[model samples]
Target: MDEALLRSLTPSVLAVLVRRGADFAAAEDAVQEALVEAVRHWPDDPPRDAKGWLVTVAWRKFIDTTRADAARRRREDRVEEEPPPGPASSVDDTLQLYFLCAHPSLTPSSAVALTLRAVGGLTTRQIAEAYLVPEATMAQRISRAKRTVSGVRLDRPGDVATVLRVLYLVFNEGYSGDVDLAAEAIRLTRQLAAAIDHPEVAGLLALMLLHHARRAARTAPDGSLVPLAEQDRSRWDTKAIAEGIGILQKALARDRLGEFQAQAAIAALHADAPTAGETDWAQIVEWYDELAGLVDSPVVLLNRAVAIGEAHGPRAGLAALAELDDSLPRHTAVAAYLHEREGDLTKAAALYAEAAHKATNLPERDHLTRQAARLNAKRRA
Candidate 1:
């Protein structure tokens, strides 16, 4: 069975059911059943029309489920009469499904889960594994998300920003378990970009491409974090970087200047450099200023300080960091780097040890611990 093909057909199949008067939750469940049946039987006897087969099976399943539930008898009459078997309507409902799954009513985590299940065609187990959560917990999260948006009208205008934010969240997850969420996010974003002509959408796609281009060099073979400055530039995907730059240029020309566009500009500048020393830190700092104006996020501030350290000096970076709350995630890490740059090895070592203690992930904690150890050894020598 072609798994990718099945996943690609999922949204349209679910859309067809919804258009035929099925509620969001039931239609999704029926479609999932159809997918399972396809996996079980398609190898021995593949259907001539994959999507049509899925729709027929799923619609039947929905009808059977409605009939089985006494409380849903009232809905039975509306769906009892099945439409003639054929291709679903040519009008693309997939885009609307994207908007619905990313509805503002749902929390960020809920929206991410629902989008993965309904739009990305991922199983709850797959999502759970990717997020490092139990399958039961993910199931409840998805169920609650479906219920939250079930009452929303299909034709309601969706906030594009919300949808983009969810996609960005997915991209940032990188990869884990069986799901390459970063790749999945790119696929979904590409679909959305095709469906709608928006600069921010293009900007986001550009940003993901540029960032993904460096994935191969983001870590050492032993899984230790490789700071961008020390990464082997030869490992970066030049093709992806070129594509991202072209897209970002077009988006920037549109003059919308959204946060994603600003961020992409910074990424593009980094990608353009042959070495860390060659990077245009001043341009990046300017872009960060624009980003700070667009989104008031602590993470952005933290990043801007790093750029300041490169563009001006470690003292300037430390001054900027001092304005931020010390409790901010990565605050100690940033301070440690700035102090090291300023030649205060003792203070840097102490800060690195502190940051290591506060690190949330194993890779990060290990990296910080190594930084402290390296600095401490150098100080002793």
Candidate 2:
């Protein structure tokens, strides 16, 4: 099968159906039908007009589905029964698909899952694998999301903020089974930045790229976490750095700063320096200040603590961390980080293990666990 061609056409197919006023469920069914048809035909007879073919087949499938379910009332036929445009759809179709998938009405988890499935052109199994959830569970989640959006009125106004949050979640997830969440996040963010004029969206795209550019050096070969100070500068993706810088510059010019824009500014500062030692920690602290002011989220404060360590000292950072609510997730992780910085490996190792126990995601928990193991091993060695 022409997998690349299918991937290329998937978003366009969904976007077309959405534009034609099919609610989310009907549109997804249409795309699924197009996918099945592609699998059947592409190997034997690859079409020169994949988009047109999918749109035609999907349109027919949507009509068939509505007709079969006598329960569903057919809406007024608003979309013209027009032929497909000459040539294929522009890449903007993919952006539209993400925007539609991340529609605000859907729950955040549902929106993320649907965007990965529809715009990301990934299978339910693939998404399931990525999030470390059972395939059946992910299937149910996606289906439930579809049902929720089925009868809702279609709105094209991009949920830029929600889209950014979804993309950030994808990026921060690091990696997963058969899916590179960071890479996917970058792709989705690029599409979002292109499709929307929101500076914060652009800021998020830049931040993801900036952090992603360093992914190679962020983990040891055995999957152990590597602190930023120890990461090899040569391993960073220079092209991604360039793009990130460009986006950050554009976002900064807008003057209407949001939390994401401030975070991007911090990432940009880190990326600009050739060496870790050269990072403008003072400037980063300023941006973090702005971010703290923008959102009262505990994670923001936690991040600010790390930045305080960089700008001030470990003792000061630990002091700042102490002031935060003890009930927050990652509280122990911040304490462990600060303790590790303070030359108190004993306390750090114990706290790291505690952090691992409290961590929400597997990668982060594993990382902290490994840190504790390494420290224990080092004491013996």
63 Cα displacement, candidate 1 (Å):
1.8
Q: After superposition, how far is residue 330 of candidate 1 from its true place, in Å?
A: 1.1
Candidate 1 on 19-65: residue-level lDDT in tens? 88899999999999999999999999999999889999999999888
User: Largest TM-score belongs to which candidate?
Assistant: 1
TM-score between model 2 and native: 0.85
Candidate 2 C-alpha lDDT tens digits along 249-333? 8888988898887887887788788899999888887888899899988888888898899889899899889889977888898
In candidate 1, stretches whose alpha carbon ends up further than 4 angstroms from where it belongs are 70-76, 84-92
Q: Residue 312 in model 1: shift from native, Å?
A: 1.3
Q: Give the range of the ten consecutive residues with the poorest summed lDDT in model 1.
A: 83-92
Provide the TM-score for each candidate, comma-separated: 0.94, 0.85
Candidate number of the best lDDT: 1
